[model samples]
Target: MLYINQQKSALQASTLADLAEQLALPTQGVALVLNRQLLPRALWAQTPLSTEQDHHIEIFQLVAGG
Candidate 1:
């Protein structure tokens, strides 16, 4: 199982892009971090996610403020 935003998740994803799709993440104004490292958007499609190990993925959405 992997953790998304500190919550445990059983969802299986082959790549970062897959995860984003599963979560219905927006194409813009979002950031993803894997194992404490910032993941570039360009690499999401190729980045592989393993189900055998415990991984932590953090997703942050940019919010507009006044």
Candidate 2:
């Protein structure tokens, strides 16, 4: 349940969805990597995040241009 939100280091999270919901982001563009292994975004909903797990999240934002 330890998650790094953007700039900050580590924080406690109840669940991965909770973190995504807090950020108002869909699980699609966000990538989860635990202990240096990349986790597929498709598994976000099913992935069980715990306090014992060390996770790194990468969120991607899309920009529109003319």
Q: In lDDT terms, how accurate is model 1?
A: 0.92
RMSD of each: 1.6, 4.0
Clashes of each: 0, 2
lDDT of 2 at 48: 62
> What value does the lDDT take at residue 23 in candidate 2?
66
Q: Please identify model 1 stretches exceeding 4 Å from their true place.
A: 63-66
For candidate 2, the per-residue lDDT at 33 reads 60
Best by TM-score: 1
lDDT of 1 by residue, 1-66 (tens): 789999999899999999999999999989999999888888999999977788899999878999
Candidate 2 local lDDT, 13-60, one digit each (tens): 565566667667763545656545665656556666676646666555
